[model samples]
Target: MRWQKSDVDKYVSAKEYIDTLIIPLIDFQMDQDLENNAFQNEVLTILSNELEKELTGRIMLAPSYYYIKTFDKDQEIVRLNHWVENVKKQPFKHIFLLSFDPAWKKSEQALDASFVWIPKIQSGDIGSKEMQHTIREQVKQIGELIRSYW
Candidate 1:
């Protein structure tokens, strides 16, 4: 299920069978390299969408949470947990926070949600065959990691 009208309607009814929530944490790097940051943002969104599509039966992909680059991770924890609280009413048992930002790795223990951090890819042509292949492989591994929790 996804954060859409019809899918969410179904989720409202069949909530028991779908117990996982996948949250994509998007970081907007306010640096000179806007192109690279844009590429990462696009791929991360695509990755999260692909994961949701592949595991549609059991996972709900929430809207990506976009935040500025300067916010402190510790402060973000409170905000992140608050978001988790609202969604928890849906009774999702396993909440996973997926990000390319390395900062999340350090704050995983403090978060109520499980954090999966992937290394940031260097700036590249997002549409190139090589990049697409790399994304496919990475998402496959990420799917397996998510499955391990189930």
Candidate 2:
């Protein structure tokens, strides 16, 4: 399920079956690397959407948690934990934080949820067949990983 009214209605009716939540950590900062950041955001969004479809009944894809790229890790971690704590009130048994940012890998241990960092695709035509294939494979692997935690 996704963060949409229709999905939320379904989720409310079947909340017990949907025990997992996937929150995409999106980075936004205007700088020289703007294009790369945008690309990563697009890819991550696609990955999150596809993953939601692949594991529809078991997981809910929360709205992306956007953060400035240059934010301090300590402060960000505290903020993110607070967000997770609130989300936990919904009875989510497993919360996954998905991102393409390498920085999160360094602070994974400090996070309140599972931190999944997928390597960023430097540049690409996201609409191309090659990209679609890659994304499908990624979703498959990620789905397996999520199921492993079950």
Candidate 3:
């Protein structure tokens, strides 16, 4: 289930069964290399969306939390926890933060949600067959990982 109007309507009565929340943490720098960063952003977003699809109706995908590449990690944690607190009102028992940013790996222990940091992919054509195959494999692995927490 996504955080969309129709999905939320279904969730209103079935919230108890939808126990997990997936929040994507996106990091990007908009400098002269905007195109590269844009590719990275799209790839990461697709990856997160695929994860959401793998377990639809069991998870809610929150809006992606985009942060400037240079933001202070501690300050961001405080802000992220604020979002988590609000979601907890829906009574989600398991929360996971998905990111390709390496910084989150270091502070994973301090976070309220389980943090899964995937290594960043080198920029490439996501439409290519090879890229699609790789993405599918990675998404399968991530789905298994998320299910492990249940």
Q: Which candidate's lDDT is highest?
A: 2
Scored by lDDT, model 2 comes in at: 0.93
| lDDT for each residue of candidate 1 in 1-150, tens digit (9 for 90 to 100) | 889999999998898999999999998977997988898899999888888888899999999998887888888889999999998887999999999988888877888999999888787787899988888888899899989999
Indicate the residue-level lDDT of 122 in model 1.
81
Report the alpha-carbon TM-score of model 2 versus the true structure.
0.97
RMSD, candidate 3, Å: 1.1
Top TM-score model: 2
Candidate 1 Cα errors over 4 Å, as ranges: none
User: Model 1 Cα RMSD, Å?
Assistant: 1.2
Q: Tell me the tens digit of each residue's lDDT in model 3 across 1-150.
A: 877899889888897789999998988788888887888889888988888888887998999998988879999999999999999888999999988888888888778999988777787788998888888888999889989999
CA lDDT, every prediction? 0.89, 0.93, 0.87
Q: Write the per-residue lDDT of candidate 2 for residues 1-150, one digit (tens) a residue.
A: 999999999999999999999999999999998888888989999999999999999999999999998889889999999989988999999999999888999999999999998877778999999999999999999899999999
